[model samples]
Target: MQFESVSESRLSFVVCFIAAFVGCAPLLQAQTEPAAPHTFFRVKAAETLTAPVSGRLLLFLKPGSGDKEVSIDEFHPTATYVAAQEIHDLEPGEEVEVNADQLAFPKAFSELNGGLYEVQAVLDTDHNYNYAGRAPEDWISNVMALAGWKPGSTAEPELVLDHHPEEDAQRKAAYEKLKGTATADVARLEEFESPALTRFWGRPTKVRAWVILPPDYVKSGGKYPTVYWTHGFGGEIDSALVSGLRIYERMKAGKMPPMIWVMLDESCPQGTHEFADSVNDGPWGTALTAEFIPWLEKKYRMDARRDGRFVQGHSSGGWASLQLEVNYPKVFGGTWSTSPDPSDFHDFTGIDLYADHANVYHRPDGSAYPIMRDKGQVLATAEQFTRLEQVLGPYGGQMTSFDWVFSPKSVSGAPEAMFDRVTGDVDPKVVAYWQEHWDLAHVVSTHWADRGADLKGRIHVYVGTADTFYLDGAAHKFDAVLKGLGADAHFTYIPDRTHFDLYGVGDDRQGLFDEIGQQMWDVARPGKSWKNRQ
Candidate 1:
């Protein structure tokens, strides 16, 4: 299982607590605090940085020297609009020099689709853009130091990244409390007994499922056409009703057709994966289909044959849906996917293409800010960077879902390759692994003709034009590849929507639900005309 970040209420409480402990009245009040004055330093590229691809370069200061804290859009000079970091406290006549080979940036210009880039540094205090509130323009000074700082005979001032220890603790605490409370109410899981179940992975894996009987289930001995609803990353078992509460509420209230909807928690321990068959992560694909489905069929009183079963999901789940149809068509009748990740690695090259920043750091002309520099000075100690690391590190240095699934080991003796998000480069092997397994375009084409006959009229896909991620590009590629392979698949694009907006809670969500429900009905029964079947 994928876990969404902690709930908002809990995060709020945590933020308040941190502010109090850190001597800030509260996050809101602290925001109003005046920025400190400081002399600016310069950062010059030891050399002209070039993009490995076409992605833009990011030269932003990370909030606390951690990936999560960096918040990319902030701190970077180019991404000033994303979220600015605050700078504090610097006396005149003091200078801090930054070094090269430590600044992290996309290696090429194509990583983020021309988004803003930032050059970041830690600061004594989080002053953000306001650090210069009353200071003279020292743009030249700042850029020069950023290029590379040589050791001076005089003692250097202490440069430091700001820390919000109290706030971070508070947020984490709140999230834990909320998760415990919410999951406490989860429905009890039942024991499984299915012979078709070849194997079970993940050791006594937390298997819990809710079987949605047909509207007329009770009167009909619980026999009904069944559809298994799986979720994408950051999904929990209850996320269906939690995140999709609005949509489910409308469906139950008659805004859309009612059918048996069985939602399974595809959420794994680490939170997410491409849901591919990886020795690195164990056999999730096998477990999901062979074990999970068989257990559901045996436990519930319903139609157990493939003809009566359908599968669907969104985002990564959407990709899973199609995978089921293509790889296990005999087990599933039809599939509905919305905003799926790319099915082919080549297509992914066009989606959120990232540059390899590590190479840039190696250039003789490429200068970088040492990880120790804070806004433009040397850090006092490693402890300081550690403090910043906790908040800003992506995954919050918490149990990263990726590591749990892909990497599987700390810097210790683990089986797979994983990178320390902070000091390590992106593991090329891991990236390659994901590309090989997760690319649908590749899978579909390679096996299409042989299996295309089995997928006719069974695949239905939808995507939003403004997808926050790269799903749109992936969908287009998938469609093109399928069309060329003689597979019967349908594609739909919803306008005026981003990723979150498309999948978010709304009354108009019926249109989306209707699309899935209709697709399920058409494939499960294969006879009556679906109202809007394309």
Candidate 2:
């Protein structure tokens, strides 16, 4: 391109400026130069004839051009960059433009480093990106590998949502095959309307579970003890069925006890209710104990006595079972909760809510608070995790789930946030409410004077010393309070264990169940072993 005649000094100044900032794109594009081309993605549904789709449109950008699919993985410390926008009734074969001008996780689209990136698009029809996470009817695009992609200088990606996992004939056939192999009792996904919850929400609400009967339940013709188990997080009725199938397999192989396993689902739209009766999430605990338990006992050959009922779970479910045992000691015989959520408010996932000017994002020294870690390595900080959750459409992330369960209802009819979403500032009023209502350690310490006899010898908690969410610190605090009360509760911290591997003992990944089951069995049959209990 030939330049028009210009002064020699002005031409020299331009050459000098270009030389000074040759590699800097922003600085090189000075006011004197023309603006750079804008970049955006064109996402569309497949050409195969189909109805219009409605959901939150998401674009995922991974940092490499490998074969690895760029999926939604907000929990990972170095997760893929994700930007989301809500789309309504998008027709098939119709293109829609998307950019990171709205909300994105970790960083925006334009700010992403220039490199090889694997891009993908998804349409979450259920508005449950935080919970369901690409479940049934969700549309997904094939992975598009881009080379030397920069924000504005290069051509952007164009993706097609061609895959629907829910409509996959192979997946549907596989699920049916599994169900066909299992007994009717083990295969059924039990669901019933929850009266207490319905009354609270002014809408029909139902509770669900997969009640996996003992292998010889039909042959024995005898009532058996029930073990109420709950999945940690991101678990629903279908996932519960998969887990129950594993338990059924173990029971059929005679590796597990003959007790009926009730796999409860704790996930709700507001996040995991954790079966806690809450103002925001509804009366899940009340509905479970008052309505579901009685109905379950009648329909199945379960021992109706409280002593024959045991509760146990992992992670959030762990905390739920612990709360049930503490809150309604007369209903449950015992609890073998493992790797429970923060049992003590004083150390809620490493944040001291009671401390002066407490902040979830940063400590007093201005260091960021780590929310997740593995093998002593900080995986994600509080700010990063929470901010990513904010970008994930707000309902089902772990932190928002906590607010629904722990915080009181605000004037706006939403759960009063315990901490600021962006600033991480903790609210003393909310923490005070959480301590009195939800904090197991605080509730037990304060109410032990009245309910000491009932809770004695009934509470049993196990957690890893190296918990992924820094839950061990809160467990230690919970243990101290129980010890001070001279409560007969047992708190075990398995050395070098993590949240995922706590149940494993050597080659037996589920050996802990046998041990926990035996202890509960002995309580039911005072002097007999598990072999003789049935």
Candidate 3:
């Protein structure tokens, strides 16, 4: 639930139908004419936009009397028969007929037995579908009543495309409310366009952060140390606001030193970019260091030197902070990362992607790999999550998010998938690319001679022994490499803690912030205690 907990809104009912056409040219020709040996399923799509519609058509099938209203959260992609077909040159106000004979089931579902099933369809106009819900431009169809569906049965349903005005209004109102609720201590949203990112994206790309000034800033008029805080996957500016408030409360109570907390927003359409420079995510690390930090230092009364700048984050953000300190040792003084995503691919969530015949679904002993749970009980397996994400569309899931930040860009403008979706086959070539570029342990161990001096005593990591995602396995691997290299790194293993409550120390859920803030102060002003402050 690491990435899943960020968005509570149920996934919009969106399914992808990947049809295998034995004869491609004949299938296109058969759109106008009928072809033998082809099972025909037809659908009609009505568009609401003025522009022509072009995207995939998703078909979902469920057995028996399906739930009257199905949320994407309740729907299991593995249990349902999902397929997709592309519709092109579809005009608005025109209900176009689509030939379903061209659609084919995935290899796993190819041999499914015919039976009574409930069906639904969605027209993804933008081609970007995620679990968080649909954009205003996307369209969905009503669930078809249960009916007998056989391989050759010619059953067609009509689907209408319309905007969810209520949902849109709700989203807009929530954002407006968040903007209006900012306190005096928690500064308003600050955003700027990064030139490096803009050039890479071929458009103006905005980077945003919340700048929380210390109490009595104008009266004091003194430079303060800065903490660059980042959020985990699916997190937004609002998520950072809570942390900013905690920092303000602690400063006001004299529990911590007065410091400027910069809560950075790393969430994007692709997923949490984690501010790592990649071929897919562009030069985020470079933009953050070369552009965002410099502008922030000059704009505010900040201590711009390396000793005064610190980094901290959890989960994906944790990985980001760790990478930032290791990659640019001179830029930031230190990083305190907690329960970060896989630091070593060798133990990436307890599965080695580089191992021979490695499958994400099963172990070498053929046992399932656990994904989400509490205590020792397994709530979901890795295959269930990955396969579910596959049917949810190609964008905005944890697995695809990693590919976006780690894998090389393919000619199709999408990141080359690191594993086969159906078979869970790990591609060694992609693993090699990951190791040479984003593998934190590999990078640090290989380049210790050059970076070791600057990075010594700067790297600190913590993970729970019972992390919900099994992240501690990778943390152990990473720590072992650092130890072997004689690096002065700190790795803490908290007993009985999980990913969700790692920040808590006893009943104080926000205790970690106080600890991290003080640590930053110690690094900034050595031998100086909070007692020495006025």
Candidate 4:
């Protein structure tokens, strides 16, 4: 057995295989059982890669018109046949038969009668399938049309795996166009590498921030108040570059005050770390407070005092900013967090992980817990998302990202899973660790006497009632705790608003930026009215 090094290409291929296997399961019944009921389905797939491929294989099945273009999002794991297979040194042009009995199927698929279905085979060469978007290296098999197919049907369609070179070219061209259009104002964004992070990872780790300098700074020899803006999950330093440019534009136009904005990037391979000092994510809170902030202050013309420093973020960033303010009260003057991720674990995404026999997949009454949504309609369940992610490998995803940030390290050198992936059994030990360390509400409630005085009137949170991820539940829980303790924390709930548009005030989507800027200005320059801005 020869093991190969796992490169980006190989990981991508492996992930593709995982996705394909999780999507469809082919049936293969034993030939010895002549009188046995037909209880199997199978599909034959051929590899089309130029080089010999050795990785995982995935098969997907969906109820659709076989002539139409198939999308991976359209097929749900619960309603489809899904299976995985491991291959070693499989040469190009080799065909393999995938058996359905070895695959996992939802209850809905078990009772399915014979019908029309489309089957596809995904050959993942590198195990990084979930992150790859229609890349040519992600070899996908031709959609096989199975009409009137029942269990143990001998009519199996042969799928030929092929790459989409044209799509890849188009994606590259679009990215190049975006890069070419970046103006001189965008060049003001500076990137920073954190020594703390490098030491933690035992390698050079870089974190970027868009440092928008105050206009006319070369002539104006004065230090300015700083706003440390954190980005939410999937947000990178480049993504916030436009916001920094807009800030410069607003300042130049006299629509906003002259203040420095530090757009910090909190994204990691495991998702946004939320900058919480954790055993798993390696003291990010400490790094941000002790190392990053001090370096930033020294390098820029920033007012180093607490009164001049403030934090603001939305969603995951929101939770992080609030956490930073609460943890290091003297370091940051205040935090204006909006639509943050669960501040209270009691209502974490509407499911209490600490509950007895808690299962993320189902509610107490045995209803499916929703995850992805659009306009209040559920697109996928929590279980479906988790299962798909599990197939996609454990390193980089929303669920695993939380584990990397909150859970303790396991003997396997990875973060301990909060719940069993297959059974959805809540791990009592993990829950206890999360509550003690990561749960903001629990931390504040337990240590109110010590930290309460400094945190008073400094913690301001905003959330929409119709937040797509049900983040409002956690916000409400945190609000109750704050009110009970007379913590002087401000909590606002907007009506009929969703997470994406929480920042929108009236008609402008970027209105929240200006609103937050004015609020920060008010805090930095007390007795100055925002209405009387020059």
Clashes (candidate 1): 73
Q: Point out where model 1 deviates above 4 Å.
A: 1-202, 243-251, 273-275, 349-436, 503-507, 528-534
Candidate 3 structure quality by residue, lDDT tens digits, 98-193 = 444344333223245677767666676665555355555666666666565665444455556543313556867876676565665457577989
Output the better candidate (1/2) by TM-score: 2
Q: Please report the TM-score between candidate 3 and the true structure.
A: 0.80
Candidate numbers, best lDDT first, in rank order: 2, 3, 4, 1
> Tens-digit lDDT track for model 2 on 1-534?
000000122234556577666775555457459534445798987778378888888888887776536775544744687788888888888878887645777666776778888888888888777766677678888889888888877765789988874455888889888777666856567888988888898898898888998878878888888988988877777777777788778777766677888999888887789888898898888999999999999899988888999899888889999999988888899999999999998898898999999988888776789888888888888888777767767778788889999999999999999998766789999999999999999899889877888888898999889888888898899889888898878999999898888999889887787778778877877886555433
Predictions in order: lDDT: 0.46, 0.81, 0.75, 0.71
Residue pairs with clashing backbones, model 3: 17-83, 17-84, 18-84, 19-104
User: Among all windows of ten consecutive residues in candidate 1, which has the lowest summed lDDT?
Assistant: 126-135
Residue 499 C-alpha lDDT in model 2: 83
TM-score of each: 0.54, 0.88, 0.80, 0.79
Winning candidate number (lDDT): 2
Give lDDT for model 3.
0.75
Put down candidate 4 lDDT per residue, 1-534, tens digits, no spaces. Answer: 000011122234445567666753331132234543424433333454567666556666777664433435622435555555666766666666665444433322334577888777776666645433233566676677878877555554566666532365686786656545445433355555668877888887665777877665656777878988887776767667656666777776766777888888787656678788777777788777888888888887898989899999888889889889878888998999998889998887888988888878777666788865557777677777776665545555677778888899999888999987766668989999999988999988888899888888888999889887788899999999999989888898989788788878778776777767777788888876533333
Best by TM-score: 2
Which is superior by lDDT, 1 or 3? 3
